[model samples]
Target: MFNLIRKDVIALKYYFLFIAAYAVMFGLFTVSSFSPLMICMLPAIMMTLFASNLELRNKSMLFIGSLPVRRKQIVLAKYGSVFVYLALGIILAAAIRAINEYGLGVEFPLTSLNLSLSAALAMAFAALYYPIQFWLGVRNSSFISFLVIFLAAALIGGIGNMADSLTFDMLPTRAQLVIGLPIAGLLLLYVSYRISLNLFLRKDIEG
Candidate 1:
């Protein structure tokens, strides 16, 4: 499993440079709290797609399956890579926010809320994205994923001001939402993972 994960990391070695560039670009340019989170997650999403493609392009699916690894392990490692990338994105977002706040003496408003919102959204995205990719194959599903990401970004960018203007009384309390959103997102991701595993197992058995 670790080697599977490592294979993805190695395959995407050059892409990390682009991911870093994206982090810096969005971190510096995006003013809205939630929007920054969206920006930070973009690379992670793209990286997950790229990693999955790496396997598909080389027929690593059959190769890995022919090895000692289980089909379930392969599915788990694929989904697990998404989580790992998300964690890295969150860390990068936090670091960028901290630098903006303390090092640059600029304020990053709603830092915690932004992190939570971004994470929940990312998880929701993965929950939707993986099943499509797994079922349709990445080649067929990539456009749909791109479209979803674009729509999400448009919503966040367009509605950020309205979201910022809303009073605390109009929405759930920060404490509640911060915990609730991530939990919901996690549940969705878990469900997606299970579905993907079942799909993979079914296909493997048939093959």
Candidate 2:
């Protein structure tokens, strides 16, 4: 299982580098907002599906599918890789936030919101996405993923705007939403994994 996860990391090495470049570019020259944190998160949300697309193209899935591994393990490994990228994004965001706050001596906006928002975004995307990818395969999943992300971004942005108009006392405590969203997101991800695991197993049997 660990090796399967490692294989994905190895295969996506260059893509990860590209994400680093993206982080640096967005980090250095950004409006101080949740946008930077959200942008940094896009890579994590995109990579698992991207890696699966690459595997499908290269016929690596055929090789991987032929292995002694279980279908559930394959799904789990893919889900695990999402966190690996999430961690990468968090580290990049933290470093960028540090540079913006300390090194530049500029007060960065949303510093308090960065980590939790990143986690919430990543987990939200993962929870919503993985089942679709597993059920539809990469090609079919791509469009829906894009559509969902777009809609979600709009909804979240609207909610943020609304929240901004309220006094701090009226807002859900940042502590509450930040913590609750990720917990809920993780539960959703687990449910998604179960659904995907079942789908993968059926596919494996049919194949």
Candidate 3:
């Protein structure tokens, strides 16, 4: 399982330079309270899609299914990889925030609220994504995922104004919300993993 996770990481090594460049460009130019959240999420989303598509293109899952590992381990490793991407997204987002706050003197800061929200949102997206990826297979899943993400982004954008005004100081139970979002996200992931595991186990890998 750890090796599977490491394989996913190594597969994306070539993209690090491009990911950094994309982050820096978006960070410096995009001036919105939501920008940090997007910065924190887009990488995870993009990488998830990219890896899924790559695997589908190469029939990698079929090969992986032939390995000594169990389907459950494969599913768990893929879930683990999501965390790796999320961590990368957070680091890049924080770095961008730091550069903007100090180097460019941008008023846009990556607040803890933003971080928490983004992390939760990323997990939420993953929860929605993995089951579909397994059930439909990656080839079809990518299109559906894109549609879902687009709709989600549009919905979020509609409420962006309201979200922009939100702050830790504004909420009565700010600490709980901050801590709870990620917890909820994890719960969602756990449920999603179970669904995906069942789906993958029953799936016809040779198809």
Q: Rate the local accuracy (lDDT) of all candidates.
A: 0.73, 0.74, 0.81
Alpha carbon RMSD to native, model 1: 3.7
The TM-score, computed over Cα atoms with residue i paired to residue i, of candidate 2 is 0.84
> Candidate 2's residue-wise lDDT over 22-111, tens digit each?
777777776456546765577787686678667766767778877898887888988888789888877777777788778988665544
Candidate 3 overall Cα lDDT vs. reference?
0.81
Clashes of 3: 0
* Clashing residue pairs, backbone N/CA/C < 3 A, model 1: none
* Candidate 1 segments exceeding 4 Å error: 29-35, 139-141, 147-170, 205-207
TM-score of each: 0.81, 0.84, 0.86
Model 3: worst 10 consecutive residues (lDDT sum): 168-177
Clashing pairs in 2: none
Instruction: Give the candidate order by descending lDDT.
Output: 3, 2, 1
lDDT of 2: 0.74
Q: Write the per-residue lDDT of candidate 3 for residues 108-163, one digit (tens) a residue.
A: 66878888888888888778888877877776866877776886677568657776
